[model samples]
Target: MLEAVVGLLLMLLGVSHGVETYCDGRQDGAQCYGALGGTVVLQLMDNTSGISRYQWSIKTTTTTTTIIRWTNNMIVINAIANRSSFTPSDGTFRINNLIWTDGGEYELEIFDSDGNISEKRTLQLTIQAAGYLPIMAGVLSALVILLVFGVAVVCAQKKKQNNKPKEKEDHELTYADVRTVQQPVRQMQKKAETEVEVEYGQVKFPERPQQTVEPA
Candidate 1:
């Protein structure tokens, strides 16, 4: 019973601490996505009414490193000591020529001359090894292959259709060749009919020989 009570008290304390931490700033910690060899900018969103000194740190799973320290002047340190720059006119941290080693949780802690924390912002960056080109290329190649295959299929179907035998026409004298053959046949029939014998004199029947019938 005592252990359960203690556990409940610790849990309440943790929740209160989380609430205070989240309520410390106007905005929550930001999340940024980046491609390999791209640039990233971490900006403090608070109204810098009376801030002077600013410090930026990057924390990985293994180590925490300070990247920027700014007061009257600005300085970049550690792994990003060369690639990082700061703009005092506006509290912006720009990291150019990003590498895969740069992916981590970045924290910006700002303080005034009185050593009061004006704003604390965290930016989480996730870096990808490759950009969109590889996936797009694969999809485009697949589409082109499918298009080529579709064209080949359509062409094959057309060739097969063209190679098929055509149906014979049953028309006898509808075409010129048919009419030419029929004209010769009709003329030959007419010529044969006209050449038959034609009688112009009166028809004479064969006379029967008279038979002598003396005894009768």
Candidate 2:
């Protein structure tokens, strides 16, 4: 009975150690895209359990270069010519100012305190030219909106100017709008007659009649 129990325990241990390790770039189609002179970060997706050290390296077609080696509370640079950083607590690695030559397969190895590799992750990194279409499109859209607004304002001003002459012409008054002209004559046979004229638009006329008469 004790032998059977030991055999079951050994089988469970083997099964536990046989679990596969998987790597993901957290990007579309499991590919990481980077730009020239930009920063690239490789993040660990697994939960931090018994991790003690981190090893980051880049594999090119003809060479494999170690970038960083990090242990708990310690960090070491292996590639002195390249700018790289490592966070040991989280097993995260960062590369600064990527160039065209930086494009390669990046490998990350997490080890326990016993120097045994606990997990390994590899991701392909590609560096390409930076994109500027979004920024240029935004600038062009703002320019177009401003141009349309300016044109609308100019058209409104021109329309107002054009309507001014027609308004003035349509507002002209005829002779019937004014009060009628009348003359008052007194009983003097030889005096010359005096007349008064009234105008439109609020001009006051004389109330008293002049004492002049026309010859009968």
Candidate 3:
């Protein structure tokens, strides 16, 4: 029974040495945005024991397969990896002068001398052109400019409205000035009509003047 228990313990210890997954450069499956001719880092790891060699590969949108190598626990991709060379060190992969073509999925495999292979770890990389950033900036600037112009136009319209006089007020003032200037002319015309009326009502008496002269 003791021998059987010892055997079981050994088996458990061996199983514990199986390959484990780890990402040192980028937190497992993190996103990185890079511009043209920019550098980005990739991370990988095999946490479990019994891992003697690591094989790294990349698959691009072009459906091309690239085999990566391990030297001194580092995966190195020379210029042959792509148009730009990439160097991996200390669980970190450095991509030099990234290009749009460099965007793709990267797979890492850890292998043991005993022919035990671990599950592949995948990391996604994205590369963009420097021009794209500038275009976004220009769009934002245009929006700001349009907003300022709209505000200025609204302010100018408000000022114009405030400066103008109301139509009703203007008409009332004009009518009042006209009536004041014509009042004196209207009064003189009324008096002339009254004197004409008195003249018409009166009659001439020539005999009255002759009697007055005889009495004197």
Highest TM-score scorer = 2
- Candidate 3 lDDT over 170-199, as tens digits, reads 998999999998998899999999988877
Candidate 1 root-mean-square deviation in Å: 18.2
- Candidate 1 lDDT over 1-216, as tens digits, reads 345445554554443212111112124577775556556665554433455677777897787788766665445343465766655555555666667777778788888788888768787777765544454455556556666767888999998877654323434325768778799999998887666532212232234567788975
- RMSD values for the candidates in order, in angstroms, are 18.2, 21.2, 20.1
Clashing pairs in model 2, backbone N/Cα/C closer than 3 A: none
Query: What digit string (tens of lDDT, one per residue) describes model 2 on residues 31-129?
Result: 676666556666644434455677767887787788767666466556743576655455455667667887878777778789989777787877766
State model 2's lDDT. 0.60
TM-scores of all predicted structures: 0.48, 0.51, 0.40
Candidate with the greatest lDDT versus the true structure: 1
Q: What is the alpha-carbon lDDT for the whole of candidate 3?
A: 0.58
Ranking by TM-score: 2, 1, 3
How does model 1 fare in lDDT? 0.60
Lowest lDDT 10-residue stretch of candidate 3: 14-23
lDDT of each: 0.60, 0.60, 0.58
- Which regions of candidate 2 are displaced past 4 Å? 1-30, 35-41, 45-49, 78-102, 112-118, 128-131, 173-216
Clashing pairs in 1: none
